[model samples]
Target: MKTTTIRTDLPREEKRKGAFMILTFFGIMATAGFLAMSIDLGVVAVFKVRMQNVADAAALAAAQEISIALDEISDQISSGNVQGEVQDANSYAQDQARVMAEHVAELNGMFIDPQIDVLFGQRTLDENSGEATITWGVSPFNAVKVIVRKDNPSQTAPDAKVDLFFAKMFDNDQVALRAEAVAYIDSRDLVVVMDFSGSMVYDSLWRSDSIDKLGQQAIDDGLYNIWTDLDSPTYGNMQFDNDWITIPSDSSSSPKVSLTWKKSTVDITTTKQLDYARLYFSDNKYQNFSSLSGQSKTLSGTGSNSGKLIKYAKVRYKENGREYYADFDLFDYDTLKRGLDLNGVNYPYPSGSWNSFISYCLNDSEVNRAGYRYQFGMMNLVHYWLDAQMPYSSTPELWKTRHYPFNAVKSGGSLLCEFLDGLDFGDHLGLVTYDTYHRVESQLVPDGWVSESVDIGATPITDDYSAIDTIQKHKQAAHYYNTTNVGGGLHEAIKLLDEHSRYGSQKTILLMTDGNANTSDNNWSVPSDFSWNAMTDYNGDGVADYTTSDSHKLYTFVRVKQAIDKGYTIHTMSVGANADRDFMKAIAFAGDGIWVDVPGGTTVAAMEEQMLQAFARIAANVPPPKLTHSESP
Candidate 1:
């Protein structure tokens, strides 16, 4: 501003430029503040999301623990623990649930204090709207709720702060956020289908499946000296004994063994015709067989109205002057093959050395030193494969009943009941056993049902589900060791679920079997009462799965589809090698359920454990946990 040019306008223009500069500076500061606020908000939003996930996870973890706790309580109850003990178990489960939630929170980088509430309660679902309402502090807590948050000064839970990433300039350096979640399981009604067939009670030694590798074990245990058909992949014989029937001082009288070949349980009066009988003896090791060198005897009575003794003889067993268990041998339809055909009683048969007949399956020489007691033990496992029910025992050991597959069935069934008893879910359990027909052993009722004893006259299968005591009830129910009728069994189970299940509750069928489903028009056919009807278009094709054929009329897999159509899921367990695994698996798939295959163990305890674990898995089976409430509280 030169004095000569100095003017008010010039001064005013300079002032305007200064004003613009100040305004621009202020605008820049405001824009920076807004950007910082956005970043802080974004960080907080992302953090809240992360915390929400942690809450959801913690809730689910705790809920899973709830299931385990239920199982524990169930176990204690099943083990005959008293009410006070059961309460203790429940308390333990509740504590463990909290522990699990905290563990999960820690895993997700959350450090929630123990004082923070991990709520246990009940959750109910709306059938029409599918909306769920949660009620906290309910008994038999079935639902779990979890909460999480960043540190807060006023909170009872541990306090900690999360500094904002960009809002510090305004004097606010921290942010607060919280999240909550809830989870639960629905109730269920279960019907158990079991098989009680005669084969279940058959001798394990007669098991033809590769699973029964008892040959080596038997040899090691020094029980058998001769195998009827050695190393054969399929056969129903493998029972032998060491005691040789003493040849009565009179040689003409043969030591005869009688076999009962009638099934009393069969509806029809039928008898088996004995085609032929074979008597085996250890010629080389006569420790069990009396050496009858140069001896001969005649067997007279097989003692069957429809059976006949074709021909029987005993002669000197000298292998070209080689003296064995006897100086002579038995030459008949069932004796040593001596080409010479010395005895007049000697008829046409497989001719060769005494070893010739059994050469293919021969494996038992030094049985005395093979171990065990008195040169042999655990014998008498022979039964005629060519016929039914004809068991040829050389001694009194035949009277000892051997329960192979049936024993496994009862043992495993008991274990299943034990598992169910532990749930404490108040879930109803019913039992349906099928042999020639179906019998409802226990109805779907609560435990400690006094009506089981008093009201039994109304129905034979009116026993209540007495928690673990159901084991004995199961044993008694499974007493019918006759022929299998899987279809009839399934039908009865389905009927039970259909008629007695609670409304709005989950319905399930647990079918356990030891062999193939009994088909029609064969030796395995069930009685007329076992007739079963089926209905299902399992493949979704236009054609129905159930047809007029016997196979279709039987439950087969159509029953699984039928159950599914009725909103009932089916889980199957196949016990022993004889169980029809493929069919059972197909049923499980169709019914939207699971299948478990358990081995037919040698010992009852071993089989019991396997069966118990299997049942446990089935009992614990549940849909994946979902977030009923996933929001900030």
Candidate 2:
């Protein structure tokens, strides 16, 4: 017992230190466990987000496929192929949905192995309560619900499983992830009314060969002969005089052929050529004929030579070692002379006709081949650009027929088809065209309307392929016609939308034109004087109406107001320089829509881009989704 208590105290102190060390070690182990758990949670969260994205894409794919299946079912029923049985239709829809989901999922990511569940149904939301409900197995099968799950034991095979890195320490090696999406075939009634006016037949630029050189040579050689034929007492009153005509030294640059004549009794050899030629006619004498140099006029009028005049005039002349031909207006020269004299300055002398005739000739052969033709206006550019974008599959026959001559191209109708080809599933499209009259090229129908009959202008079908096929076929057959009837086109489009569009669907009209409302037939009630018949009634009231006039513009405006009042959106596109941009803008403004102006002289690529952007904007402006219910539970 001698000092042993002291030794016991030291041992007790060592034991206490050991106990403290054990507590510290345990605390460290607990902290590390929590850190591992956090890291595992972060990894799981990343996988979960990725899986959700995959599921979203897969669900969309499945919904689209189901929509297509519904279209097939409708076709079968319409064709008397499918008997009265819902199971067969549902089975086909389920199979297609599963297949499409797996395909899209595989494309999105490699780690996503999902089980897709599809339900054909309708989703409704109570406006008063803000509550949404889904009714399954609904008739018409306009909606599809897609559930995508990974590692869900209750789901079918090929469930998605994500491996754990740090959570394995807690005896968890993997985690299951799931997501879902629902989609409905939004019934969209769209009308695409394009211009098929006579201008559409022209190319963007004409070839240099379009000039009628042979006709121009005849004019140059026969102009004086015609003067000789106009016999009168005043013809010889000025007396016959010495005259000499000198061809221009540099016709390409100067474009002037000097004509000098002397009436005075002077030495003919000493008389100098007049600095400027003057033509003495009945009441007026035209001076400074050089002013006529380089002018171009389209040859057209009521005359025996009208056919010859409508094409072009070529004034052939020789300058330095090159032979050149210039464009000139030969037919109706008297009328042209009067028009040029209206200003009372810059008169067209008889010599000025030659000078003016040669003014437009570019001596450079390359320029002649590549120079832009004025007759081929902005509308042609739009058509050419659209033609360039068409697929080879759709262009073979068109190219051989329409595009081969003068390197001409198809119209904007093809571009509309190309756009339709890229549309999302469940979008419905209709086609219309306007010239002298509005023609229904194709009726409004869902994304899948591919019966052969549909392609041949029959009513829209509910087949297995894309509605774009029917639209494209119709567009290919479109041809240029005389006159622009925007009112008629819009009227037909609105009527189609009003009559055939499904309830609760988005309605749109795409009105395109290259010109103002200049043409009106008996159908539109516009008088021959191009004036609005103010007394005609538009609203069916017996009284003569002042509110609805009878001009093409008033008719179009009335239709636009009606469509707007009915909640229809209209998008207007002015395609060419002739297109009345202000009119189009007003129409779009009235309809609460957008106006797209592709002005003249822009590149083809620019035209295409503008058109595509307009369509994209309209598509994006759809009403917000009615109800999107997630299948999380």
Candidate 3:
């Protein structure tokens, strides 16, 4: 009965069940096989990727090492060639490669038990090429190879590799990793331009708006801060009206060594001599007396001008207890300070203190000279200042000239006056203004000293502008404000820099101005003929022609030549809405200098920071070479 009933229907269910069993067996087997394949594939991929990474890193490391070694080798070879030594260049190259490889491997992580194989592939009379191979195994059966080919005259890529774990299952060969890199030796000597301007002044100001300095002690501290922050021993500084005092006297002064008033006496040998003149007031003029009587008087003369007295004073210094007064018969409006000395002899007056205390009446000879008339006032002040500043020493003989003390004095004027006037203008004026323009001729831009001449001839101000009144005007303004022609100052700096370059010493020029350079083409001209384009070859061809343009005229060749002649580098920082950005950039480019924008005006801290950064950057660029090692084959 059951068997009879289950015949056909049971046959269908049983057949279906049988089919399911067969399908499940096949599915299970397929799933297991697929998972096994995936696991193996994943393992192979990870190993391949890891090995490739090692190869790439090793190759890069090897290439970098090779590059550095090659640079040293090249230098050594060049040195040998210069000495006419026939060296085995091939041996040198192999040694370098092996050393580089080993050193690189040491720097790598401990996980990479890398093996380096270096080979001297080929060589020529003046060139060589080599290969550095790095190999590391991921597993017992997996390996990666990286090749770094360093060729002379031309370098090749760094090769890297990645391997599949089971790739070797198909063939008994391990996978290869590939990566490439190329490198070359830098053959140019880097030239640095550092900023050494007094605006780099770090001290806080009392009336930051006025020259009446309050916290000089604070200023001294700031200055020391600045001094300490200066990165390089090699630098040039310019203080608008002070002497160019260099620091570290042993360093070369070829490129117009410019330091400010704080430099030691031994630093800058040259000084802006102060003007000295014996000013005489007639007894009548000194005591409300009228016109001077035309007369001849005799007195003594000493030192270089030592001779018989040709003139005499009608009055002498009278001691009225606490105050010393000169007795003159007449003190009149027309009467001006006269140049007379201890001998009572009238002498040509220069600015700064006159050594002689003798007073004298004005002779006809005094009024006869044209220059003596207008300069008489300045002459008197110079004599007074020098007497107060350097009371002990006998005035130097150079003071006799019209530009004496101003040309001879070491540190001249107050710091406020110098920065306000313009750093370049101050340096050019140097001892001239400080000493009161005694030996002006000596300060004349020397002939081969500069690479170019600044056409300051077009300047309207041929007369000395170092008067206390004039200086006071600048000192009263913000450090970043300018009431004068910055263009002229920049141009002057260039010419001066060129002059310093001639002495086989490098120079750096720093200029800071509040206003843009004069855009007046009518009054200014770039001295192209005498200008040295610093961006070009020192001999003058790598850059474009230096031209005169109203927009770009301020820091043209005339100004830059001074730095170029002395192998100087110039750095300029400024504050002003009208400041010439393009011109500043050009000056920076030409002088190998930098131009910084003091966004918040020229604050003592901001200016100092900018200058410090510039100095550090320069120092970094010229850092001395350091030694490192690598593997070799």
Candidate 3, residues 346-447: lDDT per residue as tens digits? 333232323321121122222222112112222222322222222112222211221211111111122212221221111122111101001111222323
Q: What's the distance in Å from true for residue 387, model 1?
A: 13
Cα lDDT tens digits for candidate 1, 363-405: 2232222221111112422222111221211111111222444
Q: What is the lDDT of residue 142 in candidate 3?
A: 9
Prediction 3 global C-alpha lDDT: 0.30
lDDT pick, better of 2 and 3: 2
After superposition, the stretches of candidate 3 with alpha carbons farther than 4 Å from their true spots are: 1-173, 176-326, 329-595, 598-609, 618-633
Q: What is the TM-score of each candidate against the true structure?
A: 0.51, 0.38, 0.28
By descending TM-score, how would the candidates be arranged? 1, 2, 3
Better of 1 and 2 by TM-score: 1
> How far out, in Å, is residue 156 in model 3?
32
- Local error of candidate 1 at 145, Å? 2.3
- Residues 163-248, candidate 2, lDDT per residue (tens digit)? 67777787877777766566654545667776766554232323222122223222222222222322211111122221211112
- Looking at model 2, how many pairs of residues clash? 11
